[model samples]
Target: MHADADIPTEIQRTLTEFLDVQEQRLAELGPELAEQVQAARDATSGGKRLRPSFCYWGFRAAGGDPERPILTAAASLEMLHVSALVHDDVMDSSDTRRGAPAAHKRFEALQRARSEASGSGGDPVSFGIGAAILLGDLCLIWADEMLHTSGFDAAALARASKFFDAVRVEVTAGQYLDLVAQASGTSDLDLALRVLRYKAATYTVERPLHIGAALGGADQHLIDALSAYGLPLGEAFQLRDDLLGVFGDPAVTGKPAGDDLREGKRTVLVAHAVDHASPAQLAEFERLFGRAELDDDEIQLLREILQDSRSVQACEDLISERTAEAMEALDRSPVQDETSRKALADLAIAATSRHL
Candidate 1:
């Protein structure tokens, strides 16, 4: 795990250098662009760096050189993740991220200050949304630029590009699926699981692993092996996240308590709750589950319902089961590097851990 710990440091370093270059280019355009670039910086800073870690360790497991320029390529995934987060926050109307104002909120404040100083009538909220959308698009573009300019030879970049493209398409499609699920208000466990698998699971773990493995020139057999280990672990990762969304400490999660409930996220845990809740509990849940203005007492009641219905326990059991499956796969994986194997195994635990 000590070796794995350096992955975030390496990713941060790569991102910092890349962003500095981006800032310099933006500065050449005008001072007006400075704030936007800073907003991108703010959004990108400070995260678990899970995607890059998975990418790095995947490359390692496939016998890539330790000194290879993989960090630059891996850091691109972080940029893509930042893009998703910015858009996601706007979609959820989230006010904060990482304990700070979300990108859209920050832009809204800027819009308000400028509007007041200039004595102009403007819709700050709309401007904020539009600007944040553009920022997300910019980060999406930067992800591609970073990977293409990562100093990897054309052959390696070509090998990795397919997975990179697939991840972007799959994640975007998954987001749409999530939007559909929420809009339809369907409690279908199948729909919820579909959203979970496509929206977060593959992009979070499998594709990143595949990209790194491809970069390492791994064969199809090894690639399939990584998928066996990555998919279940990825689902467990999101399941843990769903639990944390409801019960995790705000300070630890960097979001307000029960934000997911407020946002009406159609998570697997919630789906399970709907399935298992008693008639009275179900009615109460239907009333209060997605209400935006739910008070503490209401939140507590929902929590009680979830607990009483054994939804929490069910999710925990799934996490344990999925994690065990991932570990078993990893144990029998064809990866020859002992350190990388251990690191991947450790990552599965960390990702699925109860801690926020």
Candidate 2:
């Protein structure tokens, strides 16, 4: 197996080479398509790369050797993640991602520039939305292509394919549920948690591990064991993300403070706050929460309510509880070696931490 540092380096290298080939192939389509392709590249660049790491370690735990093929397969998961992110930004009408203009926003700026140059009449926002959606679809297709073309043998790919397929289906269903939650404007804890499970939890952790284990020819017992370890860890990871969405530094999280509150996300934190709030607090919260135009003072007030209502503490407790459960499961898992266990343990810490 390669050193820990090599994994990200190798994944980056694999993705770069693959994208280069794609760029070259699309070059024949002309310069008009160039910027659109570049948007896809930008969307995929830079993140924690947690999904790939989990897949790599899952393979290791299942007794698979460290190899470039696994990295390629893992990198494909990153491609899928990018697809989700680009589409998500569009759905959420987000302005920035990773400290830069999001895919749709970037395309919007391009359209605006072109319209100005040609003295043309067109709706830049609509153009951007249409283009970004197509870009997301392209990324989705490329994800499947990357996975199939990853140098794993046909038998291994076949073994892993079901998990890959399931991940896509589950994540899409989760996305739909999220849309419903946001539109319904309800604050039920059960609904909030269900969205978290399918949208972020399983997608973020369990299925990636399953794919890697299947690729390594792990039996049903090992697959179930990974689920035991991964599911809670994934939930904890998303809880941390929900907290950060409201509290993290923009420099670190690449979004405005209280962005989730502004979006009126029906997170477990919000549900808890609603459950615990006084009637007056609930009335005020209903008025201010999820208003995109919420000012700094309003955001701070909302933060205070969350703290005063003990919603923040409740979320912290859940994170700790879920993390403890994950650690216990990991301890009991039938992994191939101590090193794999150690790597996964480190990942659990990093995945749920505020500063990761």
Candidate 3:
């Protein structure tokens, strides 16, 4: 459970170099688009670049060079992630992200300022949302372009492209399931776990590792082994994120406390709480969940109930189990490189560790 700040020196060096290259590439799009890219890049700052690190090490594990195509692909994956976050903030109506004003909100404020100066007679919020959406789309397009132009061999390109496409489809399907679960009040734990696999696990860890491996010319056996390790590690990562959404310190997580409660996300933790809640607790949750007007006191009470009901403990136990499975999978992997294996193991620890 070491802090992400305590990442191994080589991994940290690789990430810093990767980010520098990304920044330089971002600057190549000219001043106007570069500002947009910079804004998007700002969204990524001040958090664990866990996914890219996974991809980088995955490449190393498969005997891939981290300097060119592999690192470029990892950067593109991060851009895709940034695009998703921008849209997610808009869809969730979140006012803050990364301890700052959400992109859409920031754009809205800028739009209003411009509109007021020019006496424009249009909806500023709508204008801002539209701008943000286009910005996200631009980032997505750039992500694809980054990967496409990396100049890998035909076979490697084909494999990586297939992985990328599958990742996109799975994430979208997971998002659909999430929306459906929210609208229908289904919240089945199995269904939630499925969403976790598609939405977070595969895209975040498994496919990234596979893509890196495929680009590096790894065989099917190695790819399958990485998937085994990645799946549980990815789930553990998201589960920890869900916990942070509710219980994390705002200063550390860069979001308001009880944000998941406010958004009414049907995370595994929430699902467990609902399943184990007493009648009175259920009533209280029914009254409070998804209410825009819920006060801090209500949020605090819900937190207490979640802790009291032992759902948090259950979630912690699940995280521990998943992390252990990830380690076991890694141990069984045929990746013989000592540095790569240690990096992967360290990544697994960093992914699920509570210290962030």
Over the stretch 1-356, how does candidate 1's per-residue lDDT look in tens digits? Answer: 23445888888888889989999998999998888889988877889999998998898888888678888889999999999999999998999999999899998999999999999958999999999999999999999999899878899899899999999999999999888888887588999999899888899999999988888888888899999999999999999999999999999898988888888899999999999999999998988877889888888888899899999999999999999999999988899999899889889988999674
- Please say which candidate is ahead in lDDT: 2 or 3: 2
Clashing pairs in 3: none
Error of 2 at 39 (Å): 1.0
Alpha carbon deviation, residue 232, candidate 2 (Å): 0.2
lDDT of 1: 0.90
Candidates arranged by TM-score, highest first: 2, 1, 3
TM-score of every prediction relative to native: 0.97, 0.98, 0.90
Candidate 1 vs candidate 3, TM-score winner:
1
The Cα error of candidate 1 at residue 304, in Å, is 0.9
* Residue pairs of candidate 1 with colliding backbone atoms: none
Report the Cα lDDT for candidate 2: 0.90
For candidate 3, lDDT tens digit of each residue in 188-207? Answer: 78877888888899989998
